[model samples]
Target: MRSAVVAASLAAVALGITGPAQAAPARTSAATAAAAVTSTAGGSITRSEIIERAQYWVDQGVPYSQSAYYRDPQGRTYRTDCSGMVSMSWHLTTSATTWTLPDYSTQLGSLDDLQPGDALNNVNTHVVLFVGWTDSSHSTATIMEEARPGTNARKTTYSRSYLNSNGFKPYRYDKVVESPVTVPDKGMTNVTAVGDLSGDGVGDVIAVEAATGDLYRYNGPDYVGRSARVKIGYGWDSMSDIVGVGDITGDGVADILAVDAENGNLYRYSGPDYGGRSARVQIGTGWDSMTNLTGVGDITGDGSPDLIAVEKSTGDLYRYSGPDYAGRTARVKIGSGWNIYTSLTGIGDITGDGVADILAVDTETGNLYRYSGPNYNGGTRVQIGTGWDSMTNLTGVGDITGDRVPDLLAVKASTQDLYRYSGPSFPGGSAVQIGSGW
Candidate 1:
């Protein structure tokens, strides 16, 4: 059961703060911020990033104003008003108004075609950023927009039917792109984890090439295709496993923990800075006995993340709780007879219980089973899939899809193809190949 893999230690954070709509302050004078850029290169952005940028304005309580402009951290200036919020969220090179915003987008046929980061525009009336549909029929949606009155930048749950009937057209940024996917050229010998390591609100992959001991961070797959795999550091092959524990330090960036293969010493690497990691700090020792380790978020209901590991000798499963980011607490045996599984990893909160859960592939049967969180004991496991032994590192990739739920990424061992598993949850979800030739 003990195998070298880059286990996802990140918590089941759905784009972190992306899940909750931020509260807004009353309308105020336009806040001025420098660093806005207007260039062709500034227009390109991922779909998930669009929503993230929209959330930034909502979280910042930017007031609505057609005349005033503010520069975002990315160095893009936009009006503080409705269309301006859309422009800033889209990172459009030019600040467009409601009437002009449609010029830069492709009009959707109906509200059903609306997506996160898409906009519902009504010319001179007003416009709002489409978050996601809050209803099955897609008539109701969650939106982020800067409007007039007391609340300026705010998130709203509104009626799409009303907007559509009122002449609000769904517009998708013409240049908006889907996240691209890529795999390591050499192979899967490296330990890898996936999360928004870049803070782009889109999931990115981080891995250590075993042969060269090099750490590489892959940017989100761009729209046209290909994730830029840039090597940022060296000397990581010594780690037996790299755990991506999501934002454990409250920095809004995902942090990683690595296990020392030789001594089982654990070290913590803070969130990546432009894919460059700081010096690793030794967090704990004597972890050499864990046959396998992975993060299962907040399993103890303590609001902190938790971990699950199988013993090297007895195959007994144990859980470690944390007082903080590194839950390097004492292990509590939760179950036994787990050695029969070839691999185990975190699948996030697949049960929809708000707590992280575990996934295991049957060594002989190749079946995928879900063990719900908080002391994964008893026979309370659920069979989620059959013939899943082909996948390794069945790890949580966070809400990379921005669907407000946790999803997982796994590697097909035989083909080296990467796949994304998402649905309502694992038991209700299916896997789709995202990248291949790893």
Candidate 2:
């Protein structure tokens, strides 16, 4: 049931570009290309956005050319071949050929598993979007694609049998959810902590200006230049007070949890941005005893943000599961002797076991250690590296490489230079300098 145009397009493309085509002179440099076609819109896109983008290509009445590339009104460029069309629809980082597209996707078992925004890709030749099912059997589907050279983009019906016969496989883009970004510094000095404040899965920096006791939030490193500063709150005058950032409410937006050094009280703040906070909900009364307070991420597996705190005097570690820290007895003692550590932060699933892990810097040596856990019960620990003593500040950043594993961001104390270090378990090696001068 494959449309004649789609079949012909496959044949035409197979005879066309066999590898990445040399981008035309007018095309933007690959490094400067947007992460997705609709990067401006921000956050994970809706299924409707995918469909609308595909429809926009059709509405443009762009005649297919093997080497034709179209720049949308928003300035994203799209090639007009089959994989190009799918790449544009998915807002891929760049134009990828059918053979290379699978590298950016997680393979699906069958056409029946396809979703509205999923793809039907014939490895090496053609790719199309699965809009919906035309039949309950899931054997036939409504697909959209740029047909062939000289043809216009169109929606057509295709049978699973026909697609499978042609070597078509199904895949979902690995970035179906937007990866976390790094927050740029905009006069952000003394960055005490970092977290995803905008809840876009990108990590923003939290800085306390010692001069004014004012706290500010900067959009993570996804933007081109220095991110604009958004003042979240005031009266955080002390640098000693601890701050933990995570989506505590499970609302998909990052929130703030802080321990006021003035009073030893823990507070949670709601966020879309940091401008306004919810009424202060005191999680604990005597936070002054807590040291190395950090967000450990669902340590209890309860689907809510769990916090880790070390007893200042004893170095005893405790995991506090929360509805909002109100339950007085929610604390579970996880380990002891944490006082030997100078810094601790969640590295976010570094073990690749689907559970968030903890990273601690040894106080005596500045060595970095990764602790794997089901719930921070002193689980297996491994030393990832040493020489972290040079870092003045360190915190868990959400995914920066788009590999789905969260990375570590550090600020060199002496230079204030920013560097992103990949999880040892991820694809890349350690440390890419992200910015200079803090």
Question: Best by lDDT, which number?
Answer: 1
The numbered model that scores best in TM-score is: 1
How would you encode candidate 2's per-residue C-alpha lDDT over 191-302 as one tens digit per residue? Answer: 5345555667656667654446677766665322235667777765532434555666777656666666567677776665444324666666787666666666665667
Off by over 4 Å in 2: 1-201, 222-227, 239-242, 275-278, 326-328, 375-379, 425-429
The runs of at least 3 residues in candidate 1 whose Cα sits more than 4 Å from the true structure, single-residue gaps closed, are 1-186, 189-194, 221-227, 273-278, 323-329, 424-430
lDDT of 1 at 303: 61
The sequence of per-residue lDDT tens digits that candidate 1 reaches over residues 216-302 is: 776653211125577777766556656766556677666766676666787767767423235777777766656457766666677
| TM-score, predicted candidate 1 vs. hidden true structure | 0.53
- Which ten-residue region of model 1 has the weakest summed lDDT? 15-24
Cα lDDT for residue 164, model 1?
41
Provide the global lDDT of candidate 2 against the true structure. 0.58
Alpha carbon deviation, residue 308, candidate 1 (Å): 1.7
